[model samples]
Each structure stands twice: as C-alpha cells, then as structure tokens.
Target: MFAALSAIGAFIKIPIGINSAALDTVPALISAAFLPPVYAGAASLIGHLSSSLYAGFPLGPLHLIIAVEMFLILFVFTKLHQAGRNVWKWIFFIVANSVLATLPFYWIISPAFFVMALPGITIATVLNAGIAIVVSPVVERVMERVRTHA
Candidate 1:
C-alpha cells in the first residue's frame, strides 16, 4: 500500500531540472520508518523508479543514481532518531546527488551544465527532506491504524 501510494506520488512532480526529487519521498520515508530495512529499501527503490518513469522527470539514466540517493535518504532519515545520529548523512546526500545525478551530463554535455543544475537539485533535496521530516509521523500513524484495522 505504501509502495503503491509512493508510485502514485511519482506523477505529482516538482521539477528540479535534471535532478529528481518528488512527493514519492514522503511515502518512501513513511515505509522506511515502519518497515524493516530490506522491505523499506526495496520500496524506496521502486518509489524512485516510479517517480522517474511516471513523471518523466529525470530525463536520462542519471536518474538511477538519484534512485540510489532516494534509497539512502529513506534509509538514513528513518534511522536518524532511532540511531540518534547527526544530520551529516542528510547533508551529504543533498550535496552528493547534485553531483551524482549530473555526472553523465558532465560526460555528454559539460561541467557547466552540471554546475548550472546543482543549485536547483540542492534546493529540491532540501525541500523534500523538510517535507519528509514533517510528514513521516502522520503517514506512520495512519499506516499503523490501517494495519490494525485490517
């Protein structure tokens, strides 16, 4: 159910140039928070793929890396409180995906293209992270209720 909702969120996009960050992360984070690691990881991976394909947002294979980033984000963010960790992973992925997602463009286009898209990617990741932080508990609670009712 969370995976399905995350896929549905794929089509509802906020474009950030060559980078991909979307509503999919919300459900992915929720799933991550609730499920075990393997399941959550798979769900997040599927969510990222669905978001890219459904929305046609990322434009190229570079989205594969972005999907990896989404997986990492879901993994690390859900673990944040439980692990009592600092925000360093969050900060790292936000900055890293900008470069990772654009590396192909670097080979095919130019460094200038990667440079141009970096700011938008950074902004999008930050915005998505903020949203994840805000909405995770709501989604988790709703899922728990649904699970118990079922």
Candidate 2:
C-alpha cells in the first residue's frame, strides 16, 4: 500500500541533483508512524527506486546507495516515532533527507553538483516531510478505525 503510494509519487517529481525529489518519503514517513520499521524501510527503498527508474536511473548503480540510505532513514524514523521523539523525528527526517542524503554525492559525484543540488533537495525534503507530518495523524486515525472494525 505504502509502496504503491511511493511509486505513484515518483511521477510527481521535482528535478534535483542526479535524481529528482518526489513525495516518496511522505508515504514512508506516514507508515513509520504506525507500521513496523521494516515496512517503512521497504517503502522508502521502493520509493527511491521507482523515482530513479522513472528518471531512467540517472545515477546508474549509485542509486542503490541512495536507496539504502533511504531505507536506513525510514528505519531510524520508525525508531524515533516508537521512542516518542516527535520533534527529533521531524528534524532528523528533514536533515537526513536534505543534507545527509546529498553529502555523499559531494565525494562520489562532485562538490559542484552537490552545491548545485542542495537547495532543491532541501526544499523538496521540507515539502515532502511537511506534508507527511500534516497528514499522518489523519491516516493514523483511519488505520485505528480499520483495526478496530476488523
């Protein structure tokens, strides 16, 4: 379900860096709020890959590294949510997605590319995470009702 949403988001992208930014992380973050870590991680991985594939894998095999990074980010996001670190989770999610995600490209790609990409990536991260934060509680309530009804 979350994976599907991520894939859907891939098409609605903002071109940035080697790859583009999309609403991919939104579904992953929302899932992280309730589902186990693995589900969120998988959602994030699928999200990134779908977006990359949509863009014809612009970074080639390097996208695997990005996917793994996304997976780890979602994992930590779930952990933070589980631990009740609401503020920290949002901060880490934005920072990890915006800054940390692009930092590696500085060494692997080029410093110039990283510099060029950071602003777009940061903007996309804030938008994506912000949307997730806003809608997650509603989704949680829906899930709660579903579970109770089931």
Candidate 3:
C-alpha cells in the first residue's frame, strides 16, 4: 500500500517554478497519521528512494537526504497529532520541512543537474511548503473520513 501510494505520488507533480516542484503529500501524510512514526518514516524514506531511483534522479546521497527530510516531517506530524494539535501544527510542519529539507538541495545540489542558478533555499522551501500546506488538509480530511467509515 505504501509503495503504491508513493509511486502514484511520484507521477503527480505540480510544477511551481524552476525552484519549487510539488508532489502530492497525501501518502506521506496518511502514513504519518495512521502508522507509528518510525514505521511511517521508514516507509516514506524507502518509498521516496525507490521513486527517485526509478525516475532516474540522482540517487545515493540525495536519497539519504530526502529520507532524512521525510523522516523529520513524518515524525513531527505524528508527534503533533498525538499532542492534539493537528491543523496548525501540520502547517508549521509543512513549512519547516519544506524549507529545511529542500533548500539545501536546490541551492547546493541541483546545480549539478543543470547549469542554472537555483532559487534561494528560503524561496524554494516556502513555495514547496506552501503547496503542501494547501493540499494536505484536504487530503487529511478525506483520509479521516475513509478511516472512520472503514
């Protein structure tokens, strides 16, 4: 289930600009919501690494970096949910995760893929996080309903 969801997410990209690329976070969000933090983090990391490798993105170190980012995001979100601070905490999580995780890659590493200067990490992070913030709640609500019904 996790692998399938992540694979689907890989194909669903929302291009924000040269700097900010968006993909659905519903799978990761759901994993964080439903599974143990460690399990979710592991699954998110593996799923992302698999997708990146399959898609021909630079693997190895980048995969590790993204795995760490996904782990942090899932861990925080799970902790916040457990603390009963669901909505606002998720917003903060998304912003912080996006900025902290993606900026370094875009600013430092992405140049290796292309000669163009990447956007500042701050800008890229906000743009990516912004999209996740907007999309995650809707996905969360739907997942909640599904879980409740099931």
Candidate 4:
C-alpha cells in the first residue's frame, strides 16, 4: 500500500539539478513510524526506482545506487523511530538523504551540481519528514481502531 502511494508520488516531482525532489519519501517516512524497518525500506526503494523510471533514468545506472541508499537510509530511519529518538531520526534523515545521498553524485556530476541541489534536497527532506511526522499519529490512531475492530 505504501509502495503504491510512493509510485504515485513519483509523477509529482520538483526538478533539482540532475535529480528531483518528490513526496515519494513521505510514505516511507510515515510507514517507518509503525512498520518494520525492512518494510519501510522496501517502500523507499520502490519510491526511488519509480521516480527514476518516470524521469527516464536521467542518471542512468546511478539511480540504482540511489535506490540502495534510500533503502538503507529508511532502514536506519525506522530503527531511530523505534528507538524513540525523534530528533535524531529527523537529523539522520536530513543528513543521510539531503547531504550524504548527494555527495556521491557531487563527485560524479560536479561540485556545482551538488551546491545547486543541496537547498532543494533539504527543502524536500523537511517537507517529506514534516508531513510524515504530522500524519503518522493520525494514521496510527486509525490503524489502532481498525485493528481493534478486526
């Protein structure tokens, strides 16, 4: 379900440098709050791939590398959420997704691309993470109700 939402989000993109900024990660972030690390990671992986595919794989094979990064980042994000480190989880997301994720591309593309994209990536990170943080509790409550009824 979350993966499907991520796929849908792929079409809604904001171009940033050679990549894009999208709401694809929001579903993964929200899922991390309640689902297992692997599940959330899977959603994130699917999200990145779908987005890359939609963009005609502008980065070519490099998107695969980014997909793996997304997977690992989401895995750790879920772990941080599970550990109850709310602040640290957001920090990790911003750093891992916005900074480190772009670092490899910096060397591959150019320092100029990295510098130009950083702000957009950071903005997307904040938007995605903020939306997830705000929505997770509401989703959790709904899930709890559904579980109770079931």
lDDT score, candidate 3, position 117: 26
Per-residue lDDT tens digits for candidate 3, residues 1-150, read 754675666665545455323343456656665678776666566656655665576546666787778777767776777687867666766566655565666665674533342344344345544565676678779988998999
What do the candidate models score in CA lDDT, each in turn? 0.67, 0.89, 0.61, 0.89
TM-score, cand. 1 vs. native: 0.69
- Which runs in model 3 stand beyond 4 Å of their true positions? 19-24, 103-150
lDDT of 2 by residue, 30-56 (tens): 988778998999999999999889889
Summing lDDT over every window of 10 consecutive residues in candidate 3, give the lowest-scoring window: 113-122
Task: Give the Å error, residue 2, model 2.
Answer: 1.0
Error of 4 at 24 (Å): 0.5
Better of 3 and 4 by TM-score: 4
Which regions of candidate 4 fall more than 4 Å away from where they truly are?
15-20
Per-residue lDDT, model 2, residue 27, is 88
Error (Å) of candidate 1 at residue 81 is: 4.7
State how far residue 106 of model 3 sits from its true place (Å).
8.0
- Residue-level lDDT tens digits of model 4 in 1-150: 998888888778876666567889989998886789999999999999998898898779988999999999999999999999989999999899989998997899999888987889888888888888898889989999999999
TM-score of each: 0.69, 0.92, 0.63, 0.91
lDDT for residue 58 in candidate 1, whole number 0-100: 47
